[model samples]
Every structure is written in C-alpha cells, then in structure tokens.
Target: MSALARTAARLLLGSAMVGAGVLHLTTQRQEFRAQVPEWFPVDEDLTVLSSGVAEIALGAAFVALPGRKRLIGGLLAAFFVVIFPGNVAQYLESTDAFGLDSDRKRLVRLFFQPLLVLWALYGGGWLRRHPTG
Candidate 1:
C-alpha cells in the first residue's frame, strides 16, 4: 500500500472515530444512552463509555499501525456492526438523543457506517486478497 494513501485514509477514519468517541464519552452521554434500543441489556453509561473508548482505540490504532491495518480494520468493522442498532434507533426515532444535529443528519450517518465497513475491509487487506483492482 502507498504510505501516503494509507496515512490519509487512516487519518480521515481516525478523526471520525476519535470525534465520535469524544462525543459519546462526554457530551452525548444522555443522548446516546437514550438511543440504546430497549432490547439491549447493557447499562447506558457502560455502553456509551465502552463504545467511545473502543472507537478512539480502533480509530487511533488504524492510523498509528499500518502494518496492523488488517487487524484494526477487521476490529473496526465488527464495531460498526455492533453499533448498527444505534443508527437504526436514530433513524426510527428521528431524534438526537445524543447527537448535536438533526434526524436527517443521523440518517445520513446510517449510510456512512456501511462505507466504514467497506473501508475496513479494504484496509484490512481483504480487498487486496480478493483482487478486484
């Protein structure tokens, strides 16, 4: 992989997660907690705190360790799947229970999560192995 491209993508992806983690960790606690679906059993604080911490770690690691990109990306993809419900909850509720913006924006975020999955797949070398490029 080109170092520059990897670096750029990593930075971009990292910033996103870092920002989100910070939001979830601090300002958006109540909002995020409220957004948790009724089906989930975890406590709001632990869920929010753990999720935020994971995002920051995965995001930062993706940038800091290119050689381990595949591992980090895979982990992040799993995280994306784990958080899919939150996105769905946001869409279903049309509320900013933990966000700073509108429902429309939250819907947009739902779409973006898939791209992150794909990015993670690519970053992790799954794409390279398949050889479509």
Candidate 2:
C-alpha cells in the first residue's frame, strides 16, 4: 500500500484505540471486565483499567509520534497478542461480553486478532522493504 494509505490506517487505528481505551475506563468497564481471564491473577478491574491506560498511551503515541511509528506499532501489535489469551478464555469458558454471546461469535472474534496485528505492522510501515514517510 501507499504511504498515504498506511498513514491513514495508522491514524484510524490510533483513533480506534483511543476510543476503546475510553470505553475500557468508562461506560464499558464492566463489559471489558468480562474479557479478563479467571486464571489471570490480576484483579479484573485493575487489568481493565491498566490496559485502558496502555491503549490510550500507545494509541496517542502512535498518532502523535510519527518518528516512532515503527516502535509504537510493534508495541500495539504485542498488546493485541498479549490480550488474545483473554479472548480465548472467553471463548473456551463460554463467558460472554461485548455481544459475543454465542460460541460462534466468540470463535469468530478470535480470527480478527491477527488482522489487528497485521494492521499495526502495515500501518507502521513494517511491511515495506523501503518504507516512505
């Protein structure tokens, strides 16, 4: 994709992350709590809150620090990977949240995680052999 497209993607993803982070800390906090795995030792509320903060920081950095896009994008992708197990637990444990009420919905949701990773990488110009700003 062109640099313009990559930039657009990066901006959109950053905006989305910011929005999601806000949700995690605000109205959707309870809903986000459902994503925390029972096996995970951290308090659900704390996890949600911390992740929310992380999302906001990373997203803001991704958008405001173009010079560090590559690093920020990688971190964002790692964040997605890190949260993936929670998604899996939700599916396997039949825990429902965020409208993923059914097994099929939860299962299908898992497939999108990789796309998020790819989006981060591509938007950060990792996919380009010669990335152009």
Candidate 3:
C-alpha cells in the first residue's frame, strides 16, 4: 500500500476502535457484558469496562502516535486475539448480542477476527519489510 493508503487505513481503524470503545463504555455495556464467557473468572461488568478502556486507549494511541504504530498495532492485534474466545463462546453457547442472534451470524463473525489482526498489522507497517507507507 502507498503511504496515503496505509495512513488512511490506520485512521479508519483507529476511528472505528474509538467508536466501538465508546459504545462499550456507554449504550452497549450490557451487550458487551453479555458476550463475556460464563466460565471466565472475571466479573462481567469489570471485564466490559476494562476492555472498553483498553479499546479507547489503544485506539487513540493508534491514531495519535504514528511513531508507535508497530507497538500499538501489535497490542491491538493481541487484543483482538484475546477477545476471540468471547466471540467463540457467544457462538458455542448460543448467546445473543450485537445482532448476532443466530449460530450462523456468530460463526460468521468469528471469521472477521483474523482480518482485524491483519488489518492492524498492515496499518502498522508490519506487513512490509521496510515500510515506505
């Protein structure tokens, strides 16, 4: 990707993360809580709130700290990986949230996780050996 394209992608992803983080902390708190795995040890509300904060911080950093894009992108990728199980649990246990009210919907959503990881990596210039973008 060209420098402009990579920057655009990074900004778009950053903006999306911020928006989702805001939703997690506000109107969608319950929805996010619902996605937490029942077997996980953390309290649902705490998990939701903490993750929301994390998303916000990571998102903002990704946008505002281009110098740290590699680190932040890796962190963002890890965050997505960490949350994959919740998405899996939502599918396996048939938990409904975020309009993923069916097994098919939930299952399909799972596929997007890897794409997110790749997107972060690309935006961070990890996909390039010596990124000009």
Q: Please give each candidate's TM-score.
A: 0.78, 0.96, 0.95
Clashing pairs in 2: none
Candidate lDDT (C-alpha), each: 0.79, 0.95, 0.92
Better of 1 and 3 by TM-score: 3
**Per-candidate clashes, comma-separated:** 3, 0, 0
TM-score, predicted candidate 3 vs. hidden true structure: 0.95
Instruction: Give one digit per residue, the lDDT tens place, for model 2 in 23-115.
Output: 999999999998899999999999999999999999999899989999999999999999999999999999989899999999999999999
Model 1 poorest ten-residue lDDT run: 122-131
Ten-residue region with minimum lDDT total, candidate 3: 124-133
Query: TM-score rank, highest first?
Result: 2, 3, 1
Model 3: per-residue lDDT, tens digit, 1-133?
6878878878889889999999999999999999999999999999999999999999999999999999998999999999999999999999999899999999999999999999998888788766386
| Model 3 C-alpha RMSD to native | 2.3
lDDT of 1 by residue, 11-100 (tens): 788778889889888887777787777667898789889988998888888878888888888898899898898778777866565452
